[model samples]
Target: MGLWTVAAMTAGAVGAVALVPVALGAVGFTSAGIAAGSWAASMMSSAAAANGGGVAAGSLVAVLQSAGAAGISTATTAGLASAGAGVGAVAGRLIK
Candidate 1:
């Protein structure tokens, strides 16, 4: 493809990747904790129920909660970036 196409794809990828944290926070997954009555709270409740009154370590709920309480790890960031890049590439092709 052209340089502009590549640039657009790269920009899209970066933008999508950057939005991950913001989106997570928007859904009540913040550094402090999951907000009461928020989507995150609901997920936690479901997870706790499924796991016998406790969220299991390494489970999806626990992992997301950890990420929210702290921040996504380098590996998670890389994985998100890769997924974003794939999405960007697909979108760019569709737009063209």
Candidate 2:
């Protein structure tokens, strides 16, 4: 009803809106990274094969897997942090 209440409500709304994008951005970024890693691995494997280097594609596979796990972990961390921020914002508005 007052200016302080209106400001708090607006901030809470902004925080809520931001939470979704923060999560979606993490997902989108991770997907792009995995796709790029897969593409690079494929290209490297082909190049090695062409050069008669008997490329061990398995190493690339391992690297890709590791990258994927790390991406997921990072996304999860970001998502949790975003959730915490959202909760804090709501709690702050409510308490005030």
Candidate 3:
């Protein structure tokens, strides 16, 4: 895949990982785990964006985050992740 493809994948993965904390938190797993996991994911995305590799990342993140915000359940995170990866893969072709 091209660079953009990788960026999108990375972004999607970051967004998916971001959900882990929010998911566990909803399940009553509120503790250091949520804080730690969220921090890690956020830091990674921040770094990517700072490095100018966040276009695809942003695309993936936007899709997954929007999906979740639209009320898609964690029950669908896995499926969403797959879909997001596919989106990332095609992002280069679609956007360029």
**Which candidate comes out best when scored by TM-score?**
1
Colliding pairs, model 1: none
Tens digits of lDDT, candidate 2, 1-96:
455555555565556555543443343323344344445446555756776865455665444444444533556545555665566556666776
Ranking by TM-score: 1, 3, 2
Give one clash count per candidate, in the order shown: 0, 0, 2
Clashing pairs in 3: 8-56, 11-57
Select the stronger candidate by lDDT from 1 and 3.
Answer: 1
Ranking under lDDT, best-scoring first?
A: 1, 3, 2
The Cα error of candidate 1 at residue 42, in Å, is: 0.8
Error of 1 at 58 (Å): 0.9
**Residue 80 miss distance in model 1 (angstroms):** 1.4
Candidate 2: segments with Cα more than 4 A from true spot: 27-96
Task: Give one digit per residue, the lDDT tens place, for model 1 in 1-96.
Answer: 766567667877688668878888988888989989899999999999998999899988787778888887888888877777777777777777
Each model's lDDT: 0.82, 0.51, 0.57
Please report the candidate that would top lDDT against the real structure: 1
* Model 3, position 90: C-alpha lDDT score: 74
| TM-score, per-candidate, Cα-based | 0.87, 0.28, 0.33
The lDDT of model 2 is: 0.51
